[model samples]
Target: MPDPALLSIKDLHISVGSRPVIEGVSLDIAPGEMLGLVGESGCGKSVTALSIMRLLAEPPMHIDSGSIAFGGANVLDLDGPALEALRGDQIAMIFQEPMTSLNPVFTVGDQIAEVVTLHRAISREVAMARALELLGRVGIPTPDTALTRYPHQMSGGQRQRVMIAMALACDPQLLVADEPTTALDVTVQAQILDLLDDLRRETGMAVLLITHDLGVVSQYCDRVAVMYGGRIVEQAAASDLFAHPRHRYTEALLRTIPASNAPGTELPAIPGTVPPPGQRPSGCTFHPRCHAVVDACPRTMPELTGEPSSDSLLESRRMSLLELNHLSTTYPGAKGAVVQAVSDVSLDIAAGEVLGVVGESGCGKSTLGRTLLRLVEPSGGQILFDGKDLTALDRHQMKAVRRDLQVIFQDPFGSLNPRHSVGYIIGEPLIVHGVGDQASRDARVDELLALVGLPPDAGRRYPHEFSGGQRQRIAIARALALDPKLLVADEAVSALDVSIQSQIINLIAQLQKRLNLSILFISHDLSVIRHVSDRIAVMYLGRIVEIGPTETIMNKPQHPYTQALLSAIPRPGVARQKRVVLQGELPDPTKPPKGCAFHTRCPMVMDICHSVRPVLEHPTGSPTTGQVACHLYQDQA
Candidate 1:
């Protein structure tokens, strides 16, 4: 006979106030298995996780119907003490944000000890010892001294580890981690995932990992459930789900990935955005954005039933608008020291090509974008636009060039003036550039709003009045107001939800094509970078460590830094593969390592890597167009 499910939800329904948020959701997880729950933001992924723990605030949320069975007991029917017992003893959950989950006033060790003391009936000293042990097990260095440190004193990765330790204090049979690694650096994410998998194997615990990153879901999850509009659109083994996703939403999500799309092609972004709660469409919620939508789709919902299969196919195939020749930017530090933000970074963006620069935070990805736009003055090297060296130009000359070299900053809220209407904000650029009179600028503003898919009347709305996606559209329209030839989009879509991110990505692609615009897209997200970039440059410690076509850099990464970054990406549906977990945080730019900056954490470091800098060059017999700055590839050439 087959083993019974460790946890099972049958026809679950949840309501928030008068609105239904989760409807007819059913899923199961077996013992010692990792199940992934995936969907875009506000798609009930976190709500589902909260439901499993019965952690929802009763006043605002209530389970209307359904049964949550755990180890033959209906968890929904458990009494207060019974539910309390079940919480830390049999089931534990790690919340999405560590900073918010943990109390700032409490020491991390004390927090974990509280869980242990509550559930285990252990003495304070014993619980404290247990907490320290857990901290050590979770890979925190100096676990002994770390016991006294508050959550605020720890780094993001360290704080997350504390949360995990607290959740595992009682050795619960089931662990629910909701977007545990979201917003974390790729290397830290890899480490956290590895620790979770290791702990699961050691303790024989089942893990339900809820995240929007399909790549992460592919690598760490054993079974997968694709959730949309409060329903399980599809569920299957990881391999089967990735191989052949039957649901159109799933298929669209898969196609939206950078790895799935070929370089220099338009990303296959799903149109529109996920409907707001209480506003979902009748019959099928995803019908509006689905490319496979039919007449029946809007009137009838389809059952998710299909066999899984795999397939692979590939198809192939610039006037220089902006160029950088060994461009460098530095800032004076506290004691005669200097912070190198961009170091001898030489690259170029063609007339209409997107050159994506990707790296971890503090790796100077944003600084490079700012440098190219001349927002940050270069300490050395040259910034050339249309064969004219920008560094040699005076402030007045550079100001004149600003009309054709615009920027879209990461935070649309801060970038856009909240006090001003969209019309005034966009027209301000035109006014500054002396492109048109007030009447002409107003007409141009309306035209620009239409170009970014906003309503003609949207110009009257303030920045705060629009949604995150809409605000981004406003930002785009403003950037296009001057008919800029080159645009610097620095982490433009990083703050948006996945579905909204796709829309903005598509909008950028459309604008690029329509305006014949050259773009310098800077972000820490490799998947998004791969999706929109013709060429990619991997940066580390203020230097371009690797540069190549998107496909070449992604598929055949020659630099160790590039390889580690790629390996750290969570590929949903693919089983856990060998990955290089980079050690330590990004080094202080003021005191960067003497040689190759990445050598501090690189897995394949050599003696020379510690003393001598490497030059970016193509490897011998590579047969691909790209460059790698690594000592390992030096011999290959």
Candidate 2:
């Protein structure tokens, strides 16, 4: 016999100011089970999770219908005192961003202990002791010292651990984790997910994990529920859902993932964006973008039913356009120490080729990009673009050279001026470079906007008037205004939703091919990197660990760090691979390890790795025409 459901939601209907948000949604989470609720942004995943705990604000948000029952008690009907007791006691939540959720004025210990003291009648000292135990359990290093530090003092991974510890303080029967690892690095994300799985087994608690990442859902959850505009489109066991997805929306969503497509090929992006809440089409909300849509799809919403569905060579003959010869960047740290952000990295990109730089945070990929563009002055080595030494150029000379180099940042809105119209934002580069008069520049702006798939009339609107994907398109138009030869995109698509991300990615790829442009694509996501890049360079602690053709690196990575990164990525519709979990967090940049910076956490580290740094070279018996820096290859060579 199976256990009864710990939390049950039946035909939930949520509304914001008479507009429907979540409609006819039902889900169940049994004790000791992990269920994943997935959908794009504004699809009511979070609202459903919030309603489970009565966390939604009233007036603006109201439950139009349905019931959420936890352990035979109706959560929506609970009074103030009962609701307070229900929260953080039998049911707990870990929000998306821990920095915003944690109190800035309080220490880690004080914040965690408050949860304990509020839920249980425990002394402050005992609560603090329990907090320490949780910190340790969640894999935080030096828990005794961490308890006294502020949220900002610790790294992102450590801060997330603190949030997890606080959620587990009361030993809740159910845990609601909402996009908890979305902003984390791949390795850190793996660690957090593994920790949750272990804790679930030990505590026998159910988890409702809400995210848009199908990969994470496939790897972690036992049961999966697919959410579309305000409704449950499909629900099944995780394996069954991935192997035999019946919903057209689910099938299209899977197609958008880069892993499901080939390298340097156009991704089959879903046509339109998710419609806004009061403006959704009559019948199926996804019908507008569905390739297999029928006349009936636009008039009738489908019922939830059981379904089954299916889902760069760097070393070539071309001349190099951009070359980095032992480029380095350093900044002064506390106590007169120098932080090596980019260390002795060397690489080249050919004309019309896309070179991807990938690694965890603080691995110097962004720094390398900025340094090569002269945005951040290099500390050593040379940047050669088209046979000209960028490092030796004067300020006036570099200013002229800027016409050929441009960059697109992660936050499109942050880079764009909210006060300016789209026309002015895109034409300002032409104006600054004195490429043409006002009329000609205005004409160029319209052409550029059209090139990026936006209409000429979109120029009159401001940045805030557009969606996230539209804003990114505007940024791309601005970056291409000068017709630059080299484009540096730094984490450009990391912030958008999955469907929107696919749109932007396909746009960039098309532009790259159409314009014959060379791009330096920097991101932490290997899957995205694989799709757009001809070649890849893996970085760790300011050094390139491996460089190779896209297929070679993905299929047969030589370096341990590269292998671990590849293993950490969650693959939809594929069985979970044995992850090469690195031991500890990244080391201090100001005071890196004596020899190899990765030696401390590498799974295949040897005695020589502690004293001698390995040179980047091709390993014996390997089929890749790539270079790797590791003693495992060096010893074999």
Candidate 3:
């Protein structure tokens, strides 16, 4: 029998400049198994992957002591020439940002062919032919036509696919993928993920996937290694980690995920941010922000120990929400096309929920959010709010219903009128609804401002006078003015810094509990999505390809498109997905896919998939809330 473990990283100690980053870090990857190394940005996950390949820039990164053993040899000890031979021939890597990774002047096909030439003694013609074949395999459309195109000519997803083809050209035993899909669209993301899944199963090659998204690791990886600062704080089976997280950091990470089941309030985010490497505390690196931190946490760092495992989720994950018949709006083109943004798309939101919508520009996620609030004209489809059909209410008749509905838009600056002061901005809802008069509105605005943690005098400041975080607070306060039952946050906090992001997330979590408001939050940041969404709907060119409870969707995403979108989220560690480097921009929405919208660049495309549309239906092993539209899962055979 073959030894399952193919690569081992042991007691690695790495330092950059004058500070230590990775200390006593260790993990293993068996053949065909993926080990996800996850943490926030600037964590040591990237350094660890680079160290295995001996790629870190010297001086700043020095591996003082460590052992990276593969194929009975210590790769760390190998000299330049030996390491050079091992680099592309045995262990390969796909870095983040394909546009910059490739040589600007080289044709994409030539770049891939160059890798084949380096590892094997092959004629230029033969190598180029092999390059074309690999590109085709990676889902690049019209490989022959694309050979002459430079990296600049290809879209981000296409460029990434070229990078994958180059990495796979040598067929290395071990592959390290870093943020391979972060730049692609939701539909494209799903396709790339499915391709990675197919390739992993076929080659049985070990993959070290690095990312910040717990959802990605839960979906495509077998094992998980949680990172904090530069240390491996926890490691466990993917399912076990989700069901019963061991570390305090891991628990906090779980709470950060926004859930549709959670009423629209605030997300319980891990307080504070990842400290810069040099500023990391003396004892436990996570102590400053850990909610359960104790005195020992500030005095001694705890070793990662395996905890009791719960297999309940190992059998099957649970479903928390379901959307049956759904319809939204659409405006087809700049001219002739009728914009039926959302039509006949039924949706459901449940108890303890946070339902998320993800789509590229103009895919109707925002429109759908408005429709839920009856802010737009709905052409058709039943909307089940809890159990009631919300469309039945008449315009003036629904005035009472407006108190329960609230929305937060993408641009915090534009969303809040500049003419109004921060206090007035928030109190507008109270005044318009006649919930309170001048004195009462003033008092209520001050109360809401304090609830969001702003000072009482903040009411006197104009919208422009406050910072981005403060402006967002004003927006949140206004949304809360109605004391609503549901809220729709549309790209509400996309522009804030990472540290501020944590604060807002924490505030939202706190507010949700204080006021039970179901939220329809929408955004493009997958990292934020993994943390905030209880359930997610992946929209492509105006159709949801996959929808399910967050954990279920993250753990076993069925649609290739959903898989690709999840795979694209960037994290600090765990190698990235290789083959699913989706190679095309979203098809022009005006002229969508003839059948399956994703088929144009799908890796596992079938002839039938092009001729017939796949229905969004339930799969047997999926959670009840999970709905996917893909030919791969169909019972056609």
TM accuracy, model 2: 0.51
Residue 427 C-alpha lDDT in model 3: 85
Comparing 1 and 3 on TM-score, the stronger one: 1
Local accuracy of candidate 1 as per-residue lDDT tens digits, 1-637: 3356788888899998989999888777777888899988878988888988889999789999999999999999998999999998899999878999899998888899999989887799999999999999999999999999999999999999999999998999999998999968999999999999999988889999999899998998887889999888877777757864657788889999998888999998888888877999987799889765544457657543221111100000122457788889999988899999999988877555789999999998998888887888899998878767898898999999887789998999999988899999989988887876888788888878878889988998899989999999999989988767789999999999999999999999877755456789999989999999989999999999999989998988888888899998998899989998899998889999988898889889899999999888887556768988888878732
The TM-score of candidate 3 is 0.49
Tens-digit lDDT track for model 3 on 1-637? 3353578878999888778888888777777777778888877888999988999898767989989889879988899899988988799998878887899988887888888888799999999999889889999999999998999998888887887788888888888988777678867767776777777788877788888777777889877888889898877778857875656777788787765228887888777888876889888898899776544457666555321122211222211122336675655477786665664565555433467888666666778788777787677776555345667878775777676678877668888888878877888877777885788678777778778999999888888888888788888988888766577888877888888888887788666644434567788765676677777887776788888878777888887877777777766787765535667887766666687878887777899788788888886554465888888777872
Higher-ranked by lDDT: 1 or 2: 2
Clashes of each: 10, 5, 66
State the number of backbone clashes in model 2: 5
User: Residue 182 deviation, candidate 1, in Å?
Assistant: 61
Give candidate 3's error at residue 538 in angstroms. 46
Can you give the lDDT of residue 290 in candidate 1? 78
- Candidate maximizing TM-score: 2
lDDT of 1 at 559: 88
Q: After aligning candidate 2 to the native by TM-score, how far in Å is the CA of 407 from where it should be?
A: 0.3
**What TM-score would every model get versus the actual structure?**
0.51, 0.51, 0.49
